[model samples]
Target: MTYSSDYLRSLVREDRVHRKMYVDPEIFELEKEKIFKKVWMYVGHESLVPDPGDYYCTTLVGQEVVLSRSPDGNINVIFNRCGHRGARVLNRKRGNAKVFTCMYHGWGFKPDGTLAGVPMKADFPGGVLEERASGMVALPRVKSYRGFVFASFNADVEPLEEYLGEARRGIDELTDRSPVGKIEFAFGCHRYHFDGNWKLQLENQADMYHPAACHASTVGPDGRQFQRRAGKEGGDAAFFTANGEAVVAQTGVRGFLKGHSSEASLFDKEQSGGVWDEYRAMMVDAYGEERTRDILKNRRHSMTLFPSVDILIAQTSVRVIRAVAVDRTEIEIWPVRLVGAPDVISTDLVKYVNITHSASSFIQSDDLEAFERCQEGLKTEGAEWFLVAKGLGDEVDEGKGVLFGPRSSEVGQRAQHVAWRDLMGA
Candidate 1:
């Protein structure tokens, strides 16, 4: 659907958006250039490449980029394409590479993204190749906030902190929960793909109204049978109830600026068992009892950072979404470990992801099914618009670029499209 900028803007209303927004191939292509390429996207955590020469390969928008750590303790995010033959210089997903040597031709670049060696130095004029900037091209801007690294192709995008806005609260909560103010990304990530638009998962992550309906089997009475069979009676109930109640406890959704949002999902203290006791003692020693309680018990479920990733603080996971096409997306979920917390704390967090949101997770399967069905349904000629006016006029000001409303409100979704329209100039 070829659309003028004015027409594109017309499709997005404060309370509703055209169905084409979710189904249009042309709109998705425009999004890659107008939004994803221009925003500060989460690449990977600094812990992913802790040592010099360590690198992680990921994509920004659609272009492949490598996040590498230099010998001088600096991080560099460079295009993976070789300066010589335009082939990918790094093939591995992640590794310790002293220099990236393109397999196509023999071109090598240092971890700092500078040209290191050429296959035959004498083949070219002495300083001609070197003077032509023959090296991996680094991204224009890169920054880290609390060890979460972000890179931007746009040279003039706002600083990471300013861009994050109130969304920082959830991220800070994630890092500050660590007794020593540090967290580690898990060694491996669990990846899942869906036959749907990438925005489907992003929007679904914080949608409170759907869980009770979509996940009825997993969290309802049927779950008790599964719990009993696994000798884990009441475990499912405790998990679901704690998160479910926490969502209800919140007065509204927090729709922060730039399409970011977070919702509190405080878990019960008993769920942590002795692990919370040990972690709490450490935190209390570092901080007072009141602060310790606030740190451990004040849980934020999903921090949806626009365009790419969502930080799942309560569950100790970081979910990165990558769009492959108009109706294809890949999601990588990484469980994180707090550096100074008790070993059991890390185990519990990782196990939560496996049970609740992993590829085989009972709860997540319901969501995936819904997303696929929505994609299929939207393809048919029926609805002209997707309604997002829930609690439209009832939203309350939460101050600091945040709007709040009932848990079922589409405040987050409305805020998200607002950013999309502004970014896409539509």
Candidate 2:
């Protein structure tokens, strides 16, 4: 069934959205064409291809693409299809390859996606294999900000930095945590899928209301969770212990334009001694005492860069969301290493990611169950809308496309649908 623009706009209201937004397969296909293809979707980081010949294979909106560094030291994102017969060129996930050759036909491409060689050149006419037609097609627009790369199919899309707007501050908070203002994805990643709509994961990232209930099993009677294996206090325990309703009220949620949003930090409790103190001293040395205090004091727990990526600052990780179908979604959780910080800090970040996001971990497992349940419940024919009215009118518009409210507010979810309605309507 084809949905009209007016109909799509009507599906999203100020306080709720139609259930068809989540359960309809047609709407999912429309989303891929309208939102994902038109916006600046994330495509790995520059660190993934540090060397000239290094390349990493990834997907955007279910289309396979390659992120490679050319000999001239420029990064390129090109379709993984072969220029000859359209077969997949690069099979491996990542490698240092000067040329990517197609197995089906003896055609090769340079790292920059230019046609390198063909099995028989003289067989075709001059116009048959022109320069433009002989090479893999690159996405229309590609840009990098602070080492994070984004690509868009629409040539007329807005500049990446401008699209990010105030959300860039959330990214700054993550990178600024490092003493040298740099971070890397050296710790690999945890990739898994959940049986639910892609928006479920995105909404849950900024949801402060569900953790206390969804993840209650992790917290014990003592109000502590995931005690450090090093026989020490603080760390993840500090975050889990403060999951009560009263404590959550202290934190807040901030929504930005283009569907970006962030959750205020819940683990900024002061650290007095041990490795944390040493880490603080390192930060103080790099950035003076005043700057370091500001950095550590106002950390953002998580930030969702609409439709694709989530930056979990407290865990030092990045979660990439991929929609497989109307009901199935895959997620990749990449742990980040803070540059120029104590080795223990990086190690602890990885450990936290493993404990919180790994497939076997209780936190992610619980959330996945909730997502699946939501998916199942939405399939019933009884309800036609999903209410997102919590803290609706209470949001304070702080000028410049920013709306914020209590930590448990559903304002962030509403902002997502607002962007969705506008895009789909367009």
Candidate 3:
């Protein structure tokens, strides 16, 4: 069934969207071509490939690609396939390799994705292939901002910063929070998948209404007391509550252009009179008292990068989203390191990632179960539309592409679908 632009636009409304958008195979295919490939999607952080010849294999919109460093100190995004039999040239997840040798055939390529050598080259038909043209294909555009790398297959796409728009502030705030104003992606990551669309995770991260309900078991009464006891064991009463779950505000949710949204709350209560005092003092020394106060006194929640990545400043975690099919999606969460900050700050950040967002996390487990259940419910043909009308009539339009409303409001979700509709040509 081919959906016309009118039909696609009809599926999305200001207050709701049809469930078929999440469950239709044809729609998913359209999304891959129109939404994912045409946008600037995150590839990796430069820290992941610190040295020349270091490469990390990853995927964008289900297409396998590699992020590698060239000997001339440049990062290159290369398609993982060998030019010769179309086999993958780099099999391992990551390594420092000067050349990639295809196991299917002895074809080799440089770390910068140039053709290096091909065994039995003399036996090839005369003039059948050219070595220079046989190198791995690179994406049309690649750019890095504040250490993060991104690529786009569309040569005519907007510049990276312009594509980011107001969402760039989230990244800036993230890195600026570090004492040295620099950060690094962590060495380890947590990867997992769910039986649902990729957009569910993006919406769930910024959906403030669910924490008390979906994460009731983790941040609820019993869990709070348990956490208190755990904190006591560690000789810190504010360990878990310092910029933790209960500190995030319900009214801080703000929607941005290009399907981006974020939650921001002043860290007023969380950064007072405890071990956090020492951390605050350290930040004060690095970046004057006022800036340190602003940094430690604020908590910025996750910011969604339209169709792919989510930046969670409070947790120092970057989540990469991959849509595998109509009903399946995978995610990889990488905790980040704030360079030159107090050791405890980094330790607490990693701790938050483990307990809240990792595969084994108490919070993520509940969310995953909810996602799978939502998928099951949508599969029954019992409903046509999913309501995002929670706070529809009362959105406050702050100037400059930012909308504010109750956390339960669908403003962010609506902004997301609006971008989806435009990109999908609906």
Candidate 4:
């Protein structure tokens, strides 16, 4: 298989993606440039930086940036490099400070990327530093759609809202479902590192077909993909904890054109119709029966931010893929808190998801082994390409977009690859 960008693009035929897209280092670099760095990448939530001077540092795509509160109490994101020595100013993943000072040369910068202080004022040429030339490297642009913060390295990209397309509907569905029109993640984040490509996780999230095969608890020997075993970890039964459930019942999983897919099966009313007695009554009373039903009974979906931003369309939490190499990937998980939900509800949100899916989950341990083994096998001469031909000709392309089968098909992967081809000029 000659690995050309055009060839890679041609391999995505509605429901299938060629294996080389995941294995090619050159293609991975191209994606980092054309998709991840070029587009608006999610940073953190507004709650993370509530007060002026409060800040959280994180990577956008692969570029180091900070989500911080400006002097006027506005949340903004800026690159974390010092303008003088280029040393990392905000080294911690998150912190609170009036300004970030470079330890190397005593260069100081405000959250808005403005130069604040300079050591030994009378040192260089005119003995005065120019504000525009000496300030920290601010992002080309920083914007947020609701609470989700995003930044772009390139200056020519479209507005974040425009880039979101119909995906904005996913955010609306997620927020409107919450009683107060906003939601947050609990238990922090559940981080994961995959030996396989990070795209595998994106495809697996809404790829209903893989759950029965790739996930243990939900995967059945036949095609049921439900956990019936009480003994040893069954199929891909990666639970949030030992002897726990792994199924995340979002409202409904749906696929968007260009590799964006989501699931909202966890909407309680739709799953159980707000029928949990007092707790259900409380939710209904707070949000109203009809509103609660809309919140809980509807299928809320998670979305792929085109390339690597997997914004689980239904929750305040998100996973950003920080790809290190073609065969190695680091994922950062960030959960937000709902503005008005009960503590217990948010606690449960983190309990199972963090326990089962994060790096710490024993359930995830088995998944790691499998993905690592798959990586090892793919490197060998055994198979030239991995098969993504599931539900090939049977895709239900609605002219606008195709809906995948049971959240288990490779349609999402194909969608992403096709989008990738278009973006990279493959």
Best by TM-score: 2
TM-score of each: 0.92, 0.95, 0.90, 0.82
Per-residue lDDT of candidate 2, residues 226-316 (tens digit): 7432214346444343444534545778888999988887664454466778888889999999999888764567889998999887677
Ranking of models by TM-score? 2, 1, 3, 4
* Residues 97-170 of candidate 4: C-alpha lDDT, one tens digit per residue: 88788999888988888889988877677935776568777788788887777788889888887778777676
- Cα RMSD (Å) per model? 3.4, 2.1, 3.8, 5.8
Query: How high is the lDDT of residue 47 in model 3?
Result: 89
lDDT of 4: 0.63
Q: Per-residue error at 370 for model 3, in Å?
A: 1.1
Local error of candidate 4 at 120, Å?
Answer: 3.0
1-426 per-residue lDDT for model 3 (tens digits): 888877887888888899988889999999988888899999999989999899999998888999999999899998999888798888899899888888998888988777889888889898765765687888999999898899999999899998889888878888887778888886488999999988788778667667656665654433341231011132221212444554333445778888888865423344444445665676788989888767654555567888888887656778898899989999898988888766666766677778778888877888999999988888787669988876777879888888886645667788888888888873
Misplaced by over 4 Å in model 2 are 227-234, 237-246
Task: Give the runs in model 3 whose Cα sits over 4 Å from its true position.
Answer: 120-132, 220-249, 266-278
Q: Which candidate wins on lDDT? A: 2
Better of 1 and 4 by lDDT: 1
Model 1 misplaced regions, further than 4 Å: 220-251, 266-272
